[model samples]
Target: MIVSGVILLALVAVGGYGLLSGTDSEMAPVHRDPAPSSTASPRPETPSRPQVPRILPTSNPETFARRVAAALFTWDTGAGLMPLDYTSAILDVGDPSGTEQAGLAADIATYLPSREAWVQLRQYATTQYLTIDNIAVPDAWSEAVAQAQPGQLPPGAIAYTIDGVRHRDGIWNDVPQVLTAPVAFTVFLACPPDGDPCYLLRLSQLGSPLR
Candidate 1:
């Protein structure tokens, strides 16, 4: 199915730190460096390990979608959560298998920054809001499923649109600033033949707003 021109509104909190402001078309993911700090202190002797977010697995697609969206958009530099840790947390929630897991790892490697960068910047997402507009199967996925073995095919596939706002405190002034954008992605779900359970099969970005 062609999922276009569909829209929805959802207001989600970012672990009680920030608020989502508007509804509109998809935007590119935003990455901004924190302004230079006026008061600089010696770097910590020992960097703390990142605290990964809790993963609450669920069979419901919509709920899982929301979780994935939030995980992809949120981060905490102050708490020592690095980009790799963030990626690991997201993977834990999805529980992908085999090649899917490998693909996710590769994607994370390509997109996430190095540990040194995280340590130097100390900038992380304070808040994020994801507005899931539509869920539908893409034609290419449908055809692929049709040609595949019954059990090999994903139970469901959906393309969803989400808008988000990432917040961070300005480095020099200590003022808060927000980076707003929208994103779209296609997700594939793996469901058991029996009455077992469901998990994320694969996720791929469809489009994003221009920076």
Candidate 2:
């Protein structure tokens, strides 16, 4: 599941992704400042909370991609689950070769709030979910594939740009509150043509997906 330099360049041309560092990849995750935290009692895990999948099982690339998108954006801060717990779920369905794990972790970090932010959100019982508007193969991807060197891309590698709305809910000062915003991004995946399950590769920068 190694991406060649040529394909990396093509992806850059199509999607405005930042240079990936730390693991010798081609895209980097956005960094955010850490928020200060206050000492507080630990929250209790709800007994009725539904179990989240670690490894999502699906051979269909589109289905896998949609699921991955949802998993990345959905979470409940008051469920006694930390950001890493949600991150683990997405990583479980990531590149099995572990080549892109570090990069993916960095990508996930940008989407999720920091530990201090999470704690503060918990006080308000903040929860978030994505309402997907559409998912399609970006036309620019065809150009990237056409220019890629032989065997440069992984088996069944594909890119899908997702358009969606993010909805955040919380109880603020004893009042229920909701916020919504539009979000878009591209998801790179490999679903071997032999019918093997799909695996997430890399993600484009948030809101800068290929057309």
Candidate 3:
């Protein structure tokens, strides 16, 4: 498991933050009035569900890291999508060897809204995306790399810590509401020196990325 392997690196904390903070508080209860279909004008059609954006193949570590970060944050509740729908997008770009897939799935579950929360948030037509402030390889990661024994790490493995703000928007009682919060996390991946594309390995706990 990737969690066990990452423990050897001593790279990150054990678990992620609690559920996306303030999601429920920011959302208002569903309104209970009914507009008669005959008296009410036709409601605008909901937009078609978007295609899940998968992480693109890339040999550049920073480029791949940024894509992973964005995939982790960008989501919509009103698009006829669920949290698992978003999860699948990231898993599509996960470690192809399947070694870390289970750990990766658990890590991802922490960063997204829960299924029950998803159903509630849908009432508000909520959406979210990240605005990255910075991305870099942390000093601790370099030290860990130097300390690693031969065969301890994968060929071309690297880590990038991302700092950003998570911005969420939703309609509440006929008014649009927006919330912004700072976020940080690390992405572990490998781009083999032999010209293969990068593949996601694991994610550090949310709010506890390596320095």
Candidate 4:
């Protein structure tokens, strides 16, 4: 009987050991979620600004005029003072703000930093060195008569604005007007064979009239 009891106790101890081992094995395993990885791509940043059209603004008239004058000087005078597609004429009366096409620079309220006439000589043989192509010597300019008839505006007639015009000599001719400052006008090729749009530019100096 003692031997049988000892054998039963040994069997019970073996069973308890088995149970503890199973429990330890289950608890030993570590649990964790997979490491996170970024899936989104980096986005580029843009400037936050109020976009406006970059153009010749009418709000600032002075700035606009100055810009135009500078451009004309470079276009016309920069070509070695060569007689270009247009001719330079005198208006006689000094008017800086005048929009007349044919005019004098001195008579105008302002002149460029320096304007000097350069006489060029052309030679084909031993003698005739001067030619009209080299430099233009003025002969005479005929007075341009008005093609349009002169008349006052009818009663209640709508009128178009003449920005710098002091007086209308006639329907087609304008009289000389004085400007408070100096300005510039550019002569352009009026019409072309290719049928491109053409226009003349008028530029007003920033400051003039010594005031």
Candidate 5:
């Protein structure tokens, strides 16, 4: 994990606040009238389900970060995974909550190629692999902590480099090629003091021409 307990404690000591101090709201209950008929109606035909890609589990924050990076870099149009599906997979791996996940979903949809575009490029079906180079606390996180008021701690963030490549079908293409040079990415994560798993708060490519 990028944010170890000792570092988190040091950060809190400097900021004069704990990481998990936010309040949570209770959901309101909904009431509905009893059904008019106890008997069930005829069932409708079930629609075919979309083929969603598998999501791997991560044991810690660093593993989760790597998984998120890999998910963002890899896609397969021929496997019936669309842009939305890809983003959904990332959301699953990150395990974010509230409107944050919705915002990320929208951002990813806008950033990646559209379904139609992917279909058009199906002939060159490519699979991308991402290798994590390093993970460290980003300067932005430190700056935010320094500027935060008492009783407020900055959100945790980790910066990591990824080397990516696109492998095309050998028969369709002469040889596989690197998509672009190694790129760095910064991912913001919510670190609760209660020892719960950290969730991704935001993601951005750092000076990477690809995507």
Candidate 6:
């Protein structure tokens, strides 16, 4: 009886092995990434903004004062002096057309104050006081000249805030003869940072009247 029991158990074990072997064979496969990643920190991208004009520096303070005096050809700060034609109805208030290439032009000489104590140009930021023609700035540039404190005013100073289009070739000159393109504008000027009281003059409004 014992021998018969042992034979039966061995037969059952053999049958179980045959059943699993008959089943479909299978194996788990591993996959690797095509490229490896670095553990180093990542870099950031820069922001894009509008461009501005590049005006040269006055070198020193005295050089600036001399240039403005020479350009207008007058030592008298009391008079209405500006750049442009000495004659012609178009230039009576001074030549706004004298400035050129809003993108590559400058009047560093006109803007910087020589006598910081007398002119008190320090009232405004150094960057503000030294910019000649901020033409590259398509948008309107603010004038803190109007908001200056007393004792800062000189005898005759004027602030021209220009806001207009840069025609195909009109960045520098406002006249059509120099430039064929018609860049329309409505720029205006206000009184000085130092001397005069609040006086306003539109570029178009002043010259035609004086003429």
Q: lDDT: which candidate is best?
A: 3
Candidate 3 per-residue C-alpha lDDT over 1-211 given as tens digits, one digit per residue, 9 for 90 to 100: 4444443344343554333322322322343345557688644454445688778888999999999999999988766667899899999988888988887888898888889888777777778999999999988888767766666668898999999999888777767888888998889888999989998888888887877
* Residue 155, model 3, lDDT: 85
lDDT tens string, model 4, 122-160?
010000000111111112101111121232111111111
Candidate 4: C-alpha lDDT: 0.21
**Mind giving the per-residue lDDT tens digits that candidate 1 earns over 122-197?**
5432333355555444445444545555444444533333344333332323445555544555444554445344
TM-score per candidate: 0.58, 0.78, 0.80, 0.19, 0.59, 0.18
Candidate 6: TM-score?
0.18
lDDT of 5 by residue, 67-164 (tens): 66666666554564567777776677453445356545654554456665555555455444455666665545555555455534324433333344
For each candidate, the alpha-carbon lDDT, in order, equals: 0.46, 0.75, 0.78, 0.21, 0.48, 0.23
What tens digits encode model 2's per-residue C-alpha lDDT throughout 1-211?
A: 3555634542331222221111111122344434445565445443444466565689998999899998988887766578798988899988888988887887777778777677667777777889999999999888887877776678899999999989888776567777788898888899998998999887776877877
- lDDT (tens digit, per residue) of candidate 6 on 1-211: 1112211121111100000001111122344444434864544434332222211224232232223222222111112212122112112222233321121112212221233221221221111111222222122222323444452322232333222222111111222221121122212222344533322122222111111
Worst 10 residues of 3 by lDDT: 20-29
Q: Compared to the true structure, candidate 5 yields what TM-score? A: 0.59
Clashing pairs in 5: none
Worst ten in a row by lDDT for model 6: 14-23
Better of 2 and 3 by TM-score: 3
Q: Model 5 RMSD to the real structure?
A: 14.5
Ranked by TM-score, top first? 3, 2, 5, 1, 4, 6
Tell me the RMSD of model 6 versus the true structure.
Answer: 39.4
Considering lDDT, where higher is better, how would the candidates rank from best to worst?
A: 3, 2, 5, 1, 6, 4
Instruction: Tell me which of candidates 5 and 6 scores higher on TM-score.
Output: 5
Off by over 4 Å in 6: 1-46, 54-190, 193-201, 205-210
TM for candidate 1 is 0.58
Q: What lDDT is reached at residue 57 by model 1? A: 66
**Candidate with the greatest TM-score versus the true structure:** 3
